[model samples]
Target: MNRNASRILAALFGVLAVTLPFFAGDYPLQVARNIMMYMALAITWDMLLRSGQISFGIAGLFGIGAYSAILSVIRAGMPAWFSILFAAIFSGVVAFVIGFLILRLRAMYFSIVTLALGEIFRIIIHNLHDFTGGPEGVVIQKGVIFGGNANSLYWLVLAGLAVALAASFWFEKSKIHFALTAIRNNEISAQSSGIDIFRWLLLAFVVTSAIQGLLGGIFVQSYGFATPDAVFSADFTLLPLAMALLGGVYSTTGPIFGAILLGLASEWLKLKIPYGHLVVYGIIIVIVILFMPQGLRQLVRRTSHSADGRSA
Candidate 1:
């Protein structure tokens, strides 16, 4: 799309997103909050993917954030808003430490370690019965933010997504973009060309982890509960991964669009086949990998190109 078209479309979407709650009911607003959360996750995942890292630890970091917020409020007597900062900080620190150790590994090795680490995280949280409330989990003792208003909660999640979107656009505009593309295409070449491979990789990992963690913070704050099974579920990782793939990896808009479609489908699927919705997600991943590897974004571009060609 041309710059003018892109600007217009962005404005249109922005207006729609901002005014949506005005027209929609509480349920739709709640559904929107979930979609926005995944949209943020998809964008964060895309950031790391741009650096050529396939991390399956979204749930691990996100759950950490969720628990961080929960613990800060319950144990430390902190406010919910401050707990969000605590969540981000705790997750960022963990990401920083882990990135130093695991970022050196490449390809499937890195992915495997990340996947294992996520399970390990869940296990540890599950076992911490005294501290984390174990299998039963804990509920919020405090009141909700915005006085528990649905519209307020909806805007809050939207604000989080906007931050993620800004971070994504920054990655594209800054020098980080070229550095990551270089690392992705050929890390050795990127290193040879004077890119600090470890630095960029660590930066990407830490930033994405922080974002995912903050989203988890929002989740727990919105719902007033957190559990090992619920927060650290495989669904968190797989759903975001599927959304990113379906929308197209390495692009912000792709994930946003993908989340919009899949997020709604997921809610419906949960009602229709609660026991098998994840199977549908698995099937979607398979289909996207096999048939539309470039995802919906590329397909949209192609269709647009064809229309433009015919017009000319």
Candidate 2:
């Protein structure tokens, strides 16, 4: 797309975001916030995947952020805003440490290690009864940066989405893109060409982990409570993975589109099926992967091309 088209689309989205609260009630606004949050997470996850790394530790980083924010509030008596910053930093540090160990593995081995790491983090938190409230989790007792309210939480989530989106866009335009593409295409060749594959991969991992942590902080604060199972649930990992895969794994826009579509569907399905909604989600994921592996973005591109050809 051209810069003009991009600017126009962004302006339209901005207008819609600003006007959303005005048109929708509190419940709908809350749903919009959830959708945007997951969209941001999905995009960040895809960003790391761009470098040919498959990370399954999103829940681990997210849980770390949640616990960090909660503990900062309860133990340190810090302000909510400051705690969020601390949570992001803490998650990034953990990611930096963990990246070194797992970045050496490739494909399924790396994925399994990350998944195990997530479980390890969850079990550790679960065992820390005094600090984390064990499996019971912690009660936040306050709202987000403000105090307590839906609109405040909505704006907080919007800010997070904005930051994540901007970072992803910057990565696409910077040398990170070349580094990631090189790493993805051929690590040996990339290294021969002087690309620090390990360094770039580690950087991507840490950055994505920090964003996941930030989102977790927002999520826990928004709900005014946190639980080990809730924060470290497979839902967080599976939903974002499905969203990215469904929309288009490698492109930024793909996850946004997929998240919006699947987020809404998942919400509605919960009300309709209550118990089996997740089954529907799994089915959707399977269908998308089987039929449109390149994602809805590719489907749309193909349709546009066919239409243009017919017109010509």
Candidate 3:
């Protein structure tokens, strides 16, 4: 679509999103919250993917943030709101330190390390039984944020989604886009062209990790607890990855579209085939990868181009 048309549609969506909880019932709002969380995670995943590095550490950073937020509240006596921000900051700092070491690796080497890191984090949390509540997890004694109000909770998650969207758009529109595209297209060429490849990669990694943590914090605060299995669930990593892939990678709009479709479908599957939903979900993802690897965005674009050619 043209710039003006895109803006108008975005504005309409924004209005609808902001006003959703006001009119919609709690169930719809809850569904929207879940979708927004995964959408944010998917966007963050794509952000890192732009640098030609595939990461499997979404759950690690997410679980870290979840624990950080809850622990800050319970141990440090931090206010619920401040704890969420603490989660983001702590996760960003951790990513910054870890990036220096792992950013040097590329491709599957980097991907494997990231995946291992998530498991390592979970194991560490498991051993810290006294502090982290071990496998049983920790709960917020003060109750959930915003007094467990569904509207407020919906808006909180929406705010996290907005942050992710804004950051992704910024990456897309600014010089970072050129830098990341160059790095992804060719690291050697990007380096020769005076792009600081490592710096750009690190920046993307840190930013995305921080956003994942922020979403995690929001998630834990919304539910009033954090468990290793729950917060660091494979779903946190896999669902977002699948959503990004199914919608289209390397763009902001792709994840949004993917998350909405997959998220709703997932909810329905849970209701219809709760015990085997994930198996069905995995089958769907496999079908998409095999048959529609380029995802809905590319498919739609190709269709539009063909229709235009026919008309012309």
Candidate 4:
């Protein structure tokens, strides 16, 4: 019964999202787009996390996508939409190459390397001033991907979110989930059970990186600019990580729930703290880890179980 209610709620939300621009102004639509974009990022993060690997390099691939698409448009004379495809493929290829080298690292070592790589990507872009516009950033001469139409741009981001959601759901339904679960529970057991650990891990990494790159391309094309600081900001890494953690680490619905709640509040928080919002984000992460590591999903389930017990 609760599952039915959740499905109904999701349907209603989808309807509202599709019809939003009819009554809402561009600002509200843009805000919704921002939420959807971050939600996609959070979902992609959790997808790779399912393999028991923690990655802090979302901004790395994201920035790669932004620059790759935009640079292709400018230097290679590709259309903006075509550049998005190139961005995804390029990011996936980079991930595939990098995964071969780094996936062998265990636990926090892998995490720390990813964090370093995010900054490394940023530094490389910052130094390539001749083509990339360096730290000053590049302003694309191209118009927005959807001709700057609020409704179209909103739908474009929504489509990307839909794809991420579909992929997450598909992952949940596939044997890959079991393999990843076994891996997360015990790599030795998984290996003994015949799981090719490195192959699955590499697949997850490449797929998630591609999705992140896809979103980044859409973002840069829509916004009409990309700078190293803007694209590779720690906010990209931290906020999505927070949303995924707050929502739920191993489920599709958790990140969606977290992103909507926190993404909405984040703008206000940034305004209030200005220079100190990252501190607030850090505090939230620490609190969630200490008090509710399973996140709001666990809380919801407990409430539902308690109500059932009371009725019984």
Measured over all alpha carbons after superposition, the RMSD of each candidate to the real structure, in angstroms, is 2.0, 2.1, 1.8, 1.8
Cα lDDT tens digits for candidate 2, 1-312: 433654686678778877887678888998899899889889888999999888887888888998888888877898888788888898999999988988999999999998998899999989989988999888866544566676777888998898788889988999999999999999999999999888999899999999999888888777767889999988888888989998888877878878888999989998999968889879988998899988877777677667667431
Evaluate all candidate structures by whole-model CA lDDT and list the values in order. Answer: 0.89, 0.85, 0.91, 0.89
Best by lDDT: 3
Residue-level error in angstroms, candidate 4, position 200: 0.3
**How does candidate 4 fare on TM-score?**
0.96
Pick out the ten consecutive residues of candidate 2 with the lowest summed lDDT: 1-10
TM-score, candidate 3, is 0.96
Candidate 4 lDDT, tens digit per residue, 1-312? 267776787788789888998899988898899999999999999998999999999999998998999999988889998888888899999999999999999799999999998899999999999999999998878577777888989988998898789989988999989988999999999999999999999999999999899988999988988999999988788899999999879989889889988887877787788867678778889988898898888777777878888531
Model 4, runs deviating above 4 Å? 271-276, 310-312
TM-score, per-candidate, Cα-based: 0.94, 0.94, 0.96, 0.96
Model 3, C-alpha of 71: deviation from truth (Å): 0.3
Backbone clash pairs in model 2 (N, Cα, C under 3 Å; residues 3+ apart or in different chains), count: 0
Q: Distance (Å) between predicted and true CA of 299, model 1?
A: 1.3
What is the per-residue lDDT of model 1 for residues 1-312, given as tens digits with 9 covering 90 to 100?
644765687688788889999999988888888888988998999999998899989999999999999988988888898898789888999999999999999999999999988888889988999999998888887767767889989988997898789999999899999999999999778988999999999999998999888888988988888999999988789888999999888888788879988999999999999969889999999999998897987777777778788532
Judge candidate 3 against the unseen true structure and give its global Cα lDDT, from 0 to 1.
Answer: 0.91
